[model samples]
Target chain A: MSTTTTAPVDIFTEKIERGENIEPRDPMPEEYRRHLIRQISQHAHSEVIGMQPEGNWITRAPSLRSKMILLAKIQDEGGHGLYLYSAAETLGISREEMIEQLQTGKARYSSVFNYPALTWADIGAIGWLVDGAAIVNQVMLQRTSYGPYARAMVRICKEESFHQRQGYEIMAKMAAGTPEQHEMAQDALNRWWAPALMMFGPSDKDSLHSKQAFLWKIKRESNDALRQKFIDKTVQQAEVIGLKIPDPDLRFNEETGHYDTGPLNWDEFHRVINGDGPCNRQRVEHHVRVHEEGRWVREAAQKVLSFEF
Target chain B: MTKTDALFHYCLRLGDDAVILGHRLAELCSRGPFLEEDLALTNIALDYTGRAELFFQYAAELEGKGHSADDLVYRRPERRYYNHLLCERPNVDFGHTIVRQFLFSVYDRYLLEELGAAKDTRLAEIAVKALKETRYHLSHAADWMVRLGRGTEESHRRVQQALNDLWTYTGELFEMDDVDLLLLEHGIAADLHTLRALWQAEVKQTLDRAGLQRPADGYMQTGSRKGIHSEHLGHLLAEMQYLVRTYPQAAW
Candidate 1:
């Protein structure tokens, strides 16, 4: 019989109350470790897969200024994935193993990225709401118990703030411009709003990892809580830009003192999460092909590492 | 053309230089000799495109036509473009691409640094912001130059040949015109005279490190800035402007 005696629930609850970090080396519930791995790895995969859409626009960016900003942003996404994978590795997963999971589709990334960036406004939307939602969750993750992830989150949050501002700037210009530009901006927002909301993952009730993940201090807040926060913050930002918040029910509730928003299209969210979104196949197939094509480069890098003295 | 018209053309010229060079590099997307190099080239393309966009946007503002960056990039016909000749040439080979980028980046670094101080506030602002990224890009191209220049006999020979093939186009970069004279009068652009010695020294050091020889200055091509281009630019525009031409305001 394996004699790795488990600690009671109170021990974890006490640690949270005391604001102590739960290091990876510390023995915890099997569920907690698995949940952390799943969440962190999903986050890492999002960062990696996120490169494609932005990269598509790099060649077509209307100006050199937009191109440079996009390039740095995409590179930052790569660097963000590296940090996240390293964070996940602290839990004893190898980098190669994690990458394999992504390559093989055994792991999940944010489904939002599967939506193709059809226009320049799409890029602007991604930077604004997508990144805006991401920053909120990342700010929460900065308080996560894992030391490495929190530190990485700090650096990522700083860079992501710039990304968010740049995206907002693009939309602000469009919103203030010609009627066609305004309509285009509104259409982009309408398409991306729900996806951006879904980036916080499933609702608290639907989230399998929420309760225990919270007790373990791996997740500081519930998905629904983060989503509400994002919606409330985004509405004000939208108003300032002269763009309407697509949801008719989107308003501040004086009674509950939070934003009263309409229910999400959970069916679409679930379908996308389960690999049936518009670009799910496209995104995965592209990734697989690129990974295969990049094998020679990886081999060459390995050879360089082992070059004869 | 009035003085402002000349200034507008000058801005368009710089914008076109970056846009065409960016378009050339964009052809290498996913066609790299290696993945890192692929990513790096795409990244460079992205940077150049971004710089071009800023210039065109500024040009439109200066012209006060309410012309968008897109109107300048997509609506204008070929004869209207005023980019330097060097950037419009084909990406002959890997050696040519790297050498071209290296040569341009060095000049760009000096030009942008000087332009950052131009009396024209918009040009100066754009130059200051662009200088940081160009500095890094120059270092990246220089690093590759040194490596390929010194790596193997074949590599050295290929890069040397690229340098010789490209040398004829370098002269037009410093060739002055009426717009240049007008801009100089306004302290809006640095005289290429101040940049020549520095550009030469930088190129020599890199070439020397790479075991390459400088091409003798026998017959340098000129006049692309005045819209007399080599045969290569036509095909480049055909491909680059395809979407905008066909769709004619398809936002997506």
Candidate 2:
């Protein structure tokens, strides 16, 4: 019965509109709290799911330096996932509950992860396009209206910038290498480019959620706006590496000063978001299988944890 | 074998043990039970791989042929790899992997400590460089074994099963051959036979605290020194040597 109270909601809304950081103990609106939990947990889930595709290549990485780099990068993703899960816990949801949602397929991770990384160059493409897009979103997220989530993003964004650069460096080297290596770089860019753009989510017009989040300052920018920023910044990077963007419509309009043109395959994006992507089932199934298998291990850890020090 | 030949073979045993175990652990990179554990396991794998590279480099120099580190790692035949049989065992499950890691880390730390004090400055330097990482790995794996062993009925059963399954391979860690004897005579290697008593005592204490049982009087499996391995090593080498085998001297 007490959960139905809404008088304090107005004050919380006012604080958000004024751009004040929302702390965990603040008497926030029920919707606000739910929204924060959902968004934060989904984000946390994304970091965890994101590790798989890149992690698959660690043993096969062509060089010692590459193996170490990929391992460290993937490790950073795990650390980021842990940090985000901790932030989500501040909203009164347990990590187990959040993990359950992800396992049960009720929660959503980024659809970009639903694609497979087929080659070494794909790792580079992921770091450049995928992580590059993530940084843009996370940089905005760092400025958003939640104390703990914002703090988490600050730490994540710092690491993410390095990830973007590492990928680009790989691409730069590959594109300059032999013909086969250059082709591999180009192939990865072509395959991953559209998926990277769709990572920003649907456009502002068709978007079903997050507008109210914007008014509350939980979302600092529109999906389409962020997507545009990703495209504008990434095109030049592709050009520098001698890899062509797959879009024929990609051109700079001097008037709008934005990279414009190209129909994003929103149908494919929707399909992937709805669990129809190439790796959607495998990704979710693997996560579920591992989680299930880990029950005994977790149980053991819990038992030890309960013993008196 | 000449003294140099023995040193070369001795270094290969060290290098191969690290490389093979590191390869097994690397197979678990993205597949950990959880994010933190994934990070933890991979971090350990990285350390082992780094140490393997150093050991292989030293071995290549000791052999003093045209061989380089990668030549030792990628070009060597299956029979030429001299890793302990304990290291090449598959990571069947988390309990199995951690238990195997725990058992080996204890031996590894002890061996590294003795090697670090060797008369050969090169062996001593490499041992000192590697001992820090071995100690860290031992702490991590030992902690996990205790947790799983004392965790729950199911956890205890699975971990106890792993301990029993892996216990036989523990004997090979103390096995010595001509290479070991030669290196020991020159004060360039540890007395592994002596370290075994220390290792077994520590293991007994650890298992006692974790509420796990250790098998007694099992037929000990040995062959790493003889270059005989289970079916797992062949598969590991096939994948590990694929690119190298395909493109000979391919530079990434």
Candidate 3:
């Protein structure tokens, strides 16, 4: 009933400010929509690219039980990716375009995945540290303003905790086992510690999108705050399992009741984000190769779908 | 062969097939043509891995040698593995994978149905549970068979090529040795010979719908029952057993 078309932006802003859920059909600022699309698609891409490192170990999982667990976990990651892609589709972007963006390096996934899963213990480290960091961020996103994204986060967090537990179990078992296994556990923690910290992304002070995303309720917590929470929870877990935190300067600050750590390697984080990490090229290349190889199959599926209609 | 020995071999064959094929499918995890297909392949992989564990556990118990399922899966040498050669065929492409899966699942579906009613209650129970899963596996692979065969000209060509290449391996699935003859006599195993005709009919029906040609039966591959395999199995086992073999005393 408003005479002016400009009133919808005011209404959308009011709805966001009031912490109302933004349904797919709800009026929203274009910037808010774009931000959600970008954020959600990147999250989805991380879920997918995250599979490669863990998938690397499925064949040599040391035991039948371990192999099955790893395969199921990776399957869940793929399912999460599917759910996230569907949620992003509600924002009006096709999965094809998003994939194109990923392959072309226009979009980014978690830089943590750009590192290789070098050994079997690396799998445990990934599930524990990487997924643990992700849970902290996703738990906050479950309260995000977008209804579909929030719902997807809710389901994903349940499985992520399971993945985290399995990973921690692996770490614990190895940490308590033979000397070689203990070494393997410690080495994995060493390699993964910094990268896992980087998973929360750049500090909020330097993050270009953090301010707008926070104002829109697309992101509820700062990267540094989430990183601190992950560290606080994970340090005790590592201690209980007998694995050392890789940080030399990490200490418990009695004043703040928080574990404070040395400065993160933002240089390496930026390097990985900019496509210079060990597995960045390999990851994207493999994805592109698989996509290209399946072109005929996807076309066949489309053709069959058409025939059915 | 005694009935117990025959049953152990039967379970080993079933377990080996599941684990080997599951390994091939797991290798396709992130390599699927798309995300949905990726998840589908891995889901099937997980199912096969689970089924493999059940079969191996039963086999280990029957062996009564203080062996665990992990020992049967990770400690066995290549020549000792009794999986059908078909299951160990490399996943060369999506067409190859689907064709291989479709071919094997048809035979597996028929085998499990008969095994589900076998006189051996434990094998029957496992088979009944597995039959439910095989039903889905067969349908999924069969659906893709039609899509790929009736899809693009390239897809049709690729899939036909895959079928032609893999046709020789199918004969091994129906081969019966002393183990099968003994188990069949006790009504503890499904008669592979009897299941062959039903498997053929079901496969032919799917192939017809997909417009795929039934490849000519030439020199059908054999020797898996005799512990002989193509070169692929050794490499597959080497990678699969490396971790457990490397640290024999270490607990995972």
Candidate 4:
């Protein structure tokens, strides 16, 4: 343990500067762990609650294949939340506490999830854009400074790619199908496009968490940078799928080599994040209902396990 | 239409297969033996239903049928449906439910992979997407198969008994008649002969892992592929089809 002659802060500073991953056992500032837990837990809650919108379409999916993919994607999201919560557990936070925070509305997930998955195309759009943007964020998080979170991201990124691909394929088929099908695809994209942009979160200038998060290497890049990257990648992908992205002002400027998009509706974003969106109360209420309904099942499992032990 | 139109019918057949199985599983919605398993079952059921919707929608388009997915699912009479009898059978208990899911998921896994190679673009694309989901379902069911099969004497014995009782129904899944023959000619449906061996290998391996003996595979049942069903389908449809039949214009 004493083999190195480096001072504590100096070693910490070097690790942070080099973007080396920090483990639970590693010595780091308490603020770093606390911040990671806060953000990661919020991310976990988002994944968990995110199940609702698409879940509504589970029984109503127009085809067996779509139902299966949607189910897998939702189940995968639950697994993802478990992984993230487990990672946060390593940071010395309790799962119950994080869940409590989520219930109390003290934590925040991605605001995009607050919107409902209203149709089959909404499922496609979510997979193509919402999950697509999430993959972008998660792929970067795979290189994040927390070892467990990074490892979790590695697994999540692999599954999320399939989700994105299936979603894109869905949109491709619809775009090439009859006019009605094309309209459904366009409608889904219109509804989801802006929310997808908001998923990257507030711009760097307005983001209070970005600097400390960036400095600690908890976040790989600034919010604005990630948002821009997502925008650039999505624009071309949308074109290939033959769907109209809702942003009327969205364009590629050859001069700056950047996408020029319309202003983000921060007001709506804030309202949704603050639990004022159309589906916010319904989503949470449903989550609670299901949880309560499953109480007996959890008890039965516990009962069976006890006998085995 | 050439045999290729059979591909369209074949897609509907696959869709109907999943939808029926999903509906059967959904019957266990609040009755799961345990919570996690309950959620898992419903999740799997939802997956099947979603897959059915995709196949049905595509099939409707291919057939030039004016029917929407809802219309195909709710408006069809029982005799017009094409699902195997095994999927429509009621879940007797946890043992029976798990056994059904375990066997069917293995079959689906193999079948979907073969369908992934279909010459028809829509079928191929649908299978490619569905194959991934089926793989997960197979793995999940396999895990439970091993757990329940090896966990306790009661679990082991009950699951084995369930397997034996349910064995006959499996034969219907491979029964290829006019629709199957037609789809095969068009490269829409997978070659069932090839899929059978893979399904056998997967189920056998999982049974072996769980320390469960293979129930004798003799005395397999048939006729369900030809629109024949067990007594359960009528009861199932009575409940499931009731809402839409009664409401007619209900939306949520």
Candidate 5:
């Protein structure tokens, strides 16, 4: 309470140790701001890039109901990206800078989106598994130390739950339908399962930023722990829907009360992160292309704004 | 046509217009000029999709044939679709998309305003609900029309090009035949011919504000009344109807 005697860095560390939130104007280490900017912007980029695959199927959504739902869901993802970009902006990075970093391959998004949403079932699988995985990590982030990011996470988590359910609903319907539909669902699950797992990032020991992140309370859970939690919950949901988890190595351990999975292909994960995945170039290219194409529109809007002012 | 038959066809035409235009907007989901614009486009697409569902459901009810809304949306072949040609035009760019949306939304706003007072309560109710959304859509599109028209030289040029290309299709929106005449007599549909003047004035005002010229009207496209469409509708349907057509018995 004696702020006159305390250093700002000590107060920052003390606040972190005492599990207090960090506001935008609060005195904090430069490293912490950098960490949140990188993480949050990457998360924002993921949301924007994530739209492409799901957007792929909006026109082909089988039912009018499904089309509306899918369109709304993609809109939600776009909205989430906006919120996140604003959140990151609080830390001093411009939206333009973050987007430039992404386009230039200096920043990274979740590698899972690099995969194509190949079938209608892929739409379901993405909603169910991909969003499901994202929710587990994001739910933990709701308690993270950063006030703005945590608040954004809280709102995002709410919509993400709906997204996950809609996805699973698609998977469930397909799993229970005709053989072709069932095959589509299963195939989608098989392809998406590992990539979804990769969404949690590397294992605790191997994760580059886990140590500092945990010490700062920016991250509330280890990547492995969060991934495990997602796996345990999702496996049963898949079982009830009569679809199998593609992981042959998956098993529930009564002792730990956790479902264990096969070793993730870290090489593939790294490869995708390094821009070798099937859709990596396509995603970034599309983003750059869209941004370039919209230059005139953005310029026009900017000119109009100036004129009005 | 009987009153009920006229009502069913009326519903289909309305539903088809919504679905096709919604489909075109949906194609721009992640491809908008920017993130905010992207979300706005999809939101409009969603509104149209929802309206299409309501219209299709009503059509299904009137037909008394147990066809679900999905069936009406997915099972119909391209030639069977009665949407105006404008609805199925490709979204060539942001300029084109905005121009197309502006043109349709102006017409839609006037049509919905009249339909909201229809003697047929169901159609009126649907129109009333839809009018709320259309007003927002029209304003959003109109704002962009002005901005793009007056914004920068490049934007003005691009949008003007889009306007000229899209002008012909606007004629088909007012191409009323038996369905409109019959439904008009029954108080189930708005008078398209009358709606056209209001639509034209509103459009001209926006164009004037945006500093753009209305294309000289020429050879207006037709045939949506007979389920005929541009080459675009067939391709749009093939992509849209693929899943349902591939698995006819499968429920989504």
Candidate 6:
């Protein structure tokens, strides 16, 4: 609000509006710094937390090829987490601090991960749908105003395209497979459909952070816009694979040339995000346990790095 | 004494070792101490599974009973799995896992080298393809062994303890039975015991480089070659086969 600071703030905002990036060393508003750090770290946490559900299927993957695909996919999520965490670090927060925030439940990852992957078909559903939504959201964020986050988003979007396709391929096979397989695929789609939608976050009116984030060019699309895009593309794909999407109200809108769907359970979404989802506690607890148990190994590795070995 | 019989069994053993170890590593997928290491371990596991599939497919072909690879991996009882006991050992900790991988990779490297030169073109071709992966696995696992051993007091102690505990199972990696002997006579299989000295030397050298001592080798454990394994194999198989067994009609 100070006269002197207003000029620099205007310049920063103007650069973002002009479609240019703000480097880490550039003078940024404290609010902008905090927002970037929070969003980027949460993004990183989602990737890290995302590994658990898919990893559950790695050992039990029915085929050699599927097993590899699942393993590679989970590994990619781990890699994404590293990239995003490193990206967040450019905003001046340490990786340990962000991880601590996650561990203490002081911060949140994607609430979608709070749902358990109960069956192998869920993997297919996730790769196809969850990743599908992420791709839409990420494609937009690739133009984010922050340089490192934008660059990281570019790399992630590249890898994520394959993830969604691989997932769809699994769904395609199951849908064409035996009756039991078709049923499993349908069940997976049923369970995952709403969740994948929720990954775009709440609607515009309900998303408290969206206005500021959008103003800062951190998110190039509203949650609703990205969700609409994902829903439009995904509904047809489900039909092609002979799987019924869970949304009973889902239909293509001829007038708008977009898919119209049922209302989301914002209460359930809030509950899950507020630590009430089925796997929310389990996921956080697992992360905490690993961090605690891994302290010695990390310390040992660090010691070697410090040449104290 | 039939070549097909010995070759079929030899290939099954190789496939079994790969899949079993691959299963163990796969279990460590999300539980890795760190992200990069998690990816590294799973990448190696992917190689193991890939190698397993190749060997299993070849074995199924040699068996000539229309048995698919799934039957070999999922339908078999624990006692029918001929993986080296070291692989069947649980990944008790990072140190133990590293030591186990180091020992197995050393044996596997030399084994692949000899097999790469087999007179049987198909087996030789498979070996030549697999040796590349095995060499990489050995170097990665060996480097970890050195780091963990030389890293700190805790890592050093844990890794040395792993070496002592796993030393017995190490002998089984080089155990050759009549099936192997029969294949060796016709150059369809390499004599596993021939690689024992090289394995020992490499292991010793790696441990020494890590500033750790190799445990004295005595009372070597054997029986995996005879389809006998530790209790751990059954637990692994239970989880791995659950989907296939519970839903015989299921297709992944």
DockQ scores of the candidates: 0.15, 0.56, 0.82, 0.10, 0.81, 0.59
The lDDT values for all models are 0.79, 0.87, 0.92, 0.77, 0.92, 0.87
For residue B133, what is the lDDT in candidate 2? Answer: 92
Against the true structure, whose DockQ is highest? Answer: 3
- List, residue by residue over A78-190, the lDDT tens digit for candidate 4: 77887898899999999878867876778877788888887667888888898888988998999888899999999889878788887888788777766767788899999
* Candidate 4, superposed: residue stretches over 4 Å from native: A1-11, B1-19, B23-76, B79-252
Error at A284, model 2, angstroms: 0.9
Which ten-residue region of model 4 chain A has the weakest summed lDDT?
A: A300-309
lDDT of 3 at A146: 94
lDDT of 2 by residue, A1-309 (tens): 697676677778778878899999988878888998999999999999999899777777765567777878988998999999999999999999998999888999999999999978899999999999999999999988989999999999988778998899989988987787788889999999999999988777655576788778888788889999988888898888899999998899999999996898899999988989999999888888888887778777876886642
lDDT, candidate 5, at B44: 91
- Taking the tens digit of each residue's C-alpha lDDT, what string does model 1 give over A51-122? 877777766665445656777787677778777888889888887788688777899999999898987778
How is the predicted docking of candidate 5 categorized under the CAPRI scheme? high
Interface RMSD of 2: 1.9
A59-112, model 6: which lDDT tens digit per residue? Answer: 888877788788888989999999999999998999889988998898889999
lDDT of 3 by residue, A30-93 (tens): 8889989999999999999999999889888898789888988898999999989999999999
Span of 10 residues, lowest total lDDT, candidate 6 chain B:
B187-196
Ranking by TM-score: 3, 5, 6, 2, 1, 4
For B1-252, candidate 2 gives per-residue lDDT tens digits of 898888888888899998889889988876788778988998998898888888888889988897878778887889878898899999999989999999999999999999999988888998998999998998898888788888889888888888889989998899888888888898887898899999989888889878888788589998879888888888888877765676563456
Better structure of 4 and 5 per lDDT: 5
Angstrom error of the Cα, residue A36, model 4: value is 1.1
Clashing pairs in 5: none
Query: Distance (Å) between predicted and true CA of A75, model 2?
Result: 1.5
lDDT, residue B138, model 6:
87
How far residue B135's Cα lies from its native spot in candidate 6, in Å, is 2.4
Best by TM-score: 3
